[model samples]
Target: MELEAKGICFRYMSKTAPILNNVDFTLKEGDKLALVGPSGCGKSTLAKILAGYIRPSGGTVLLDGKPLPDQGYSPVQMIYQHPELAVNPRWKMSKIAHECWTPNDELLKDMGIEKEWMSRWPTELSGGELQRFCVVRALGPETRFLICDEITTMLDVITQAQLWQTILDIAEKNKLGMIVVTHNNYLADKVCDRVIKLTDINHI
Candidate 1:
């Protein structure tokens, strides 16, 4: 499978300048691509478009030459930089984690998710701990592409390394396509097979 973004354009408001213009890229199974650019360069905006979080003003995001599904579980899943904002505050960690699918024990272990934490609320966990759940939740078997938008930016080096290792292992095992958006060049080099600069593709 392949995820392709073609001629994508986006703007926050009609009166404001476009944030992304004519951005394009493709990611296929087993393909790990890093998107790098300065902050506010629309790297995150493009990632959202690809993940079906927002509609592009003037283009298409296709999965395997067809439009992404509008209903049911999307083959594309995105893990955000802030896990707290992504989950529901009213639910426990177990409910949030199982909202999509019940991740196996082995997967949870690899992600360093404690079984005890599952009974607690999001507010009870540290940022690093919350992020582990976010990562595992996005790795369901149906996910064919994963968009990671600076997902480990708030963590320490040790936690970041552990999370990345688990993510890479899971992606490889599932043959999932990955788009990693970040400003960290070292991280891009370490995790991606190829890199695309947002400025190079976005004309805004």
Candidate 2:
């Protein structure tokens, strides 16, 4: 999926401060972009806007060169810091995985999650395990772009490395475009093809 944001600006009604100011960028298929900024610098907000979750107070977000469309082909997906929150507790692991089902039944197993774990509840899984599923679910067919918002922040360094490798492999294998939202400069440099500093935009 191709994405473009031009002169985007936004501010919360609850606060007088503006979060994003005249931000602009683009992500083409298989392009990996890292958004870096200090806390409260609008990284997550911009990610949400790009994912079509929040409407910008000004400017526009276009997906595939067209204005935002409702119920589109699930062209974009998000992997949040906490995967369990993204997964439903009442739903079985299989149901959660079904949200973005793939023909490769061995993918999760290859990620070190056993096939039997698919039957367990998300709450029963470890943080790292749940995160692997989150990547799996988002990378499944029908998803073309991913907004990864500090997805590995909660995992241990080892787990973070493993998960990052998995996500990178999947993105490369599928030629998926990705927007990596994070404050971790190291991870950003390691994962993204280009880095955009939102704090600099805030000053412009």
Candidate 3:
């Protein structure tokens, strides 16, 4: 499988300048790509566009040479930087975690998710804990591609390492295409098979 972004472009308003301009990239199955750029360079926007979270002002995202589906569970899934913003505050962790597909207990344990925390509310967990749930939620069986937008930037070093390890392991097992968006060059180099700078791809 291949995920392709062709001539991608995005802007806030018609009158405003485009943040991404005619950007293009492709991630083949089992490929891990690191999207590196400074803040406000449209890395997050491109990630959203790729995962169908938002439409680009121009261009298209293709999965296996066809446009991404407009409905149903998208093969492309994204995990955001802030897990708190991604979940429902009122739902229990179990519901939120299983919102898409149920992750096995072994997978949950690998992600450092404790069973007791399943009954708690989003407000009851720390950012790292919440993020673990978010990651597991996005890793549903149908997910073939993953767009991670600074998902670990807020966590401590140990937590970051642990989460990345689990994610990478799963991706390897599933042969999933992945895009890791971040500003940290070292982390990108460490985790991704290839890295691209957003500024280099975005003409705007």
Candidate 4:
């Protein structure tokens, strides 16, 4: 199975230059791909498009030769850079964690989430703590592909390693395809099997 972007093209406005132009790629199941590029080069935009969060001006994102599901739980899940922006401020951590499906104790423990933290609001937890919830939330059983848009770039080294290990382990066990989008070439090289520069694919 593969998550493929076919002839992808996009722009925020008609007058503005295209953010992405004729981009394409395929990430097979269980394979990790690093999408590396300079800032404002549309890596994150492409990530969102591949995850079905944004509609492309031209072309389509296909998962195993079919379009991504429009309703219900998406097999393609995206974890953003800022955990705080991803969660509902009014919701508690427990609710956010269980928004998709209730994560088992083992999974929570592996993600380094303490039991008590679930009861607190999003504001109560630190960035790293909240990010743990975001990652776990995206790991619902229905998810087959993950769009990691610099998910660990803001964390301390130790926290980044721990969170990434947990994510890598789970992805490996489930054979999930992952698109790791980032500007950090070193981190991308360390985590992904294949590295693609956005400039190489995006004509814009």
Candidate 5:
């Protein structure tokens, strides 16, 4: 794993609302880290920084003790709160899954999703199914780390629990590092090895 951020700073263009200031953290292999804070506290911003989606105004982000790439996404992938929004409307579920991994009908069935659903469009599937596919997509080739941004926010409690367990199991099996960003402390306790409160980070 080996992720770290030193003296990070970020601000939005809308206002001087400094989202992150001098944020510092480290995540090693098999680390299940949770970033928790109130909305607008910059938890998501920091997550973006970790994933190399956004650059910090100051400081550095490293992976395996080396600075992360400047352009293009990191090997790290993200699972968002809404899977439907993440998938393309025109592509069939099978296509989406294939883009992530070789088609394995057995795996789909084991995920409690029928193989027949593979031919269906994103809009044809239920929310949970869509999200399951979204997770699969992010777990595709080259993915070593996952930045889960409140991924279960759009699901029901039962679905959330099931998905969380599945994700944790997958991460452990694959030795994948994860940074889970959520405001829900309870969920954090259930999923993360250690939790950090974003509000505690200092700024310049």
Candidate 6:
């Protein structure tokens, strides 16, 4: 499978300067690409566009040469930087984690998710813990391309390493494509097969 964004352009409003301009990006099965750029350079915007979370102002995002399906779990899944914001505050961790599909015990254990944590609400878990749930949920069987938009930025070094290892293992096992968005060069080097600076593709 391949996720491609061709000649993409976007801006929040008509009056504002464009966040992205003629951006082109691609990720194929087993490809782990890091998207790096200075802050506010529209890296996250492009990630969202690629994951079908937001429509681009111009151009198209295609999965295997067709528009992403509007209904059902997207083949392209995105794990955001802020887990707290991604999940429903009103729901328990179990509900949130299994909202799409129930992950097996082995998968949860690999992600460092404890069974005890499942009974609590989102606020009850720490950032790292909440992020574990987000990662697991995004790794459902339907997910083909994973867009990790600064997904480990908020974690401690230990947690960061652990999370990345788990993600890499899952990707390798599933032959999943990944687009990692981050400003950390060391992390980009450690996690991605190739790193592309957003400015190199974003004409703006």
Pairs in clash, predicted candidate 4: none
On a 0 to 100 scale, what is the lDDT of residue 108 in model 6?
95
lDDT of 4 at 178: 92
Q: Which stretches of candidate 2 lie over 4 Å from their true place?
A: none
lDDT of 3 at 187: 92
Worst 10 residues of 6 by lDDT: 44-53
All models: lDDT?
0.93, 0.83, 0.93, 0.92, 0.80, 0.93
lDDT of 5 by residue, 1-204 (tens): 688888898887747877778888888778899988888778777888888888887788888878887655357788877788889899998888877567355545545677788889999998888888878777754667899998888778988887787778778877888999987888999898998878776553
Candidate 3 has which clashing residue pairs, if any? Answer: none
Q: Over all chains combined, what TM-score does candidate 4 have? A: 0.98
lDDT of 3 by residue, 49-107 (tens): 99998899999999999999998888999999999999999899989988998789899
| 62 Cα displacement, candidate 3 (Å) | 0.5
lDDT of 1 by residue, 32-107 (tens): 9999989899888888889899999999999999999999889999999999999999999999999999899999
- C-alpha RMSD of each candidate structure in angstroms: 0.7, 1.8, 0.8, 0.8, 2.3, 0.7
Clash pairs, candidate 6, are none
Please give the RMSD of candidate 3 to the true structure.
0.8
Lowest summed lDDT across 10 adjacent residues in model 4 is found at 182-191
Model 6, residue 26: displacement in angstroms? 1.7
TM-scores of the candidates in the order shown = 0.98, 0.91, 0.98, 0.98, 0.88, 0.98
**What's the residue-level lDDT of 153 in candidate 3?**
94
